[model samples]
Target: MSSRISTTRVHEAGIETLQKRQVELAGAQERLTSGKRVAKASDDPAAAARAERALAGEMRAQTSERAVEASRTAMSLSETAMGDVVELLQQAREAMVAAGNASYTDNERRGLAEKLTSIRQQLLSVANRTDGAGSFLFGGQGAGSAPFVDAAGGVQYRGIAGERRTEPATDLPLTINGDGVFMTSLTGNGVFQTSAAAGVTQAWIDNGQVSDPSALTGSTYTLQFSIAAGATTYAVLENGLPTAVTAAPYVSGRDITVDGQTFRISGAPASGDQFTVQPSTATLSVFDTLDRAIGQLGTPSRTAAQIAQGNTDALRDLDQSMSQLQGARAAAGEMLVRIDSETGRLADQKLANQSERSRAEDLDMTDAISKFQNLQTGYDAALKSYSMVQRLSLFQYLNT
Candidate 1:
């Protein structure tokens, strides 16, 4: 009987119960104040691990987004630079057309040539455009220096043949090649240059270009000049076979018309002098064509025939260059569209990841507050009961 109602044992039980209640109350208060269900891994290890993984994914996505943005900026700059190039090429083309005017004196044509030189320099500057980080845009994985250099009286491409891409978005090509944009070669056979035959030093392919590419047979033709009874005549041969077309009288300083083409011969040609008219398959640089135009304009006493030929060649090369510029611009525009689309995707993905992380670890304020109030009521009741028990005697409840 003494053991069951022992005063010391009762006091010890009361104190232990009160202490447990107090600890529970304090823990509840902390949870309410901090507003986090899982402040540490010990609180909820699985939830903490899930939140950590989501956060890591979100960070990676953000990094990729930054790279995409950088690529977009670079592509925008490339398009702008190419646009400027097209404008300059147009200006050069107009100058070439103006130089062809027969009424313009040599001095006036010289002014046009000077203007062309300026345009070429400006084009070079445009081609050597860089990103915000100062890396060359068209360097094609080469050194950061200018890809085009003035060498041997013409511009040369020092960069590699292809473009370099960016990290994180390796599928996207970020840069344009220098050769494709600024140094396109001539089309057709390698006859961009013309030379007079051994005996016919004065006759050449003056300003000769294929006016109509579709009409070209790609066959070599020969001009055989014959002196019949002191009257000069020349017949064209298609692969050593003479056509039914009769030999026409040769007149100095006049154009000889053949197969929708014309040739002007000023210097005297002896009989049996042969001239070959072959299509050019070799490629020439755009800058070379510009230089040729300038050189033609600067030439003193160029006949109307020479001016006409120069006009045709310059205009053709300019058209080709403009076409190439448009192609490059289209590619850049496409890349911009892709970047924008992918950026939208990344933004959506980041939001999803954040939402997952929040669900895993964020506190529920309503539940936490209710739990704190319950623990507080329990703690107050336990304190009052412990104080009463400590003062009560063994016979108190029986007497009452």
Candidate 2:
């Protein structure tokens, strides 16, 4: 226990032991106060770095969870909107068929016309559907307003040609074209049209005629049937001339003239009752087709074949229009489905990422508590040894 600079083993050993005790106490206090073993980098640089990384990952995951939920919600809203479009298209198709019925009274036909008009309005509404945030469903990136507008205040599409998509997951993209604009082609004039009555048939004029001939106007041809004779004979005349042709093409509905009386058979034409165009101009509109079909219903003047044929053609056109609309609806449905699937998949990915990040950054309370306890015990032991050794210093007992 002798004291000297280099030779005093007791003093050096005791001093070293006291320093060690102080370090132990510092460590214990830090673990108890902070509830962490590696508070600083120097404490255990490697462990601190790993734990810090894990904790950072947890924070990032928590933050991203909100965004993931938002994406899922957006996709869900888009799908719901698309469902409405399908319903509207179905209604429109039904109205078109009702207008085409041959047995319908004029009043009934007019009612059907009104219903057809309503379908157009509904179609516009479907095109204009918006999300909760007031963004248009089919407006592409510019969701500022309704996607459908109209000429004469009727329904027309105003949306962008392209589609909008959402990114909910990596390598998977979801689309929300709930407005159905993507599949439907332009729907006016050239799209849904009736031929001009005054001019010669386009096919005839195409054969190098100098000028298109004016069509006969305002004629009703009577078709008589004698079941006893088993004969269905219909008389035809163009300006009172029997311009009989074996086959007549009626791209547009026929112009009927019978016994100096004139009635225009204007509607979708049937196969056997096609006639030359009348001098009257061709009427075509979203409303035109339905109005004409309604007007022709239950007209006793027109022949049975003519009536039946007109209605059949009208129905067929309606079916064609529905076909087009259904295409758009189908496309919308496909996109909605794809979007929902991608959104769900993306949600799963986000959840996984969140879990990984949390694992990376979260603190293990149990492990931390155990470490702090061990540090406390070691500190207490070091204090006890320090007290015993420090009290026995060479001059301390003599002074006491």
Model 1, TM vs. native: 0.75
lDDT per residue for candidate 1 within 1-400, as digits (tens), equals 3536578888898889888988888877777787767789998999999999999989988888887887788789888998998899999988988887778999999999999999999998888888868777777766557899988879999988787776744355667787887776444223333334654444444545445555657666777888888898888887778876558788876875555455566556778877666655435577887888889889888766556656765786777668778888888998999999989988998999998998888878888888888888888898898888876885886788
* Candidate 2 structure lDDT: 0.47
Candidate 2 has what TM-score?
Answer: 0.55
Worst 10 residues of 1 by lDDT: 187-196
lDDT of all predictions? 0.77, 0.47
Writing each residue's lDDT as its tens digit, candidate 2 over 121-205 gives 6655655666667767657656456766666644445555555443332222133443333333333221222222221111110
TM-score of each: 0.75, 0.55
What's the C-alpha lDDT at position 301 in model 2? Answer: 53
Give residue 194's error in model 2 in angstroms.
10
All candidates: CA RMSD in angstroms?
5.5, 11.2
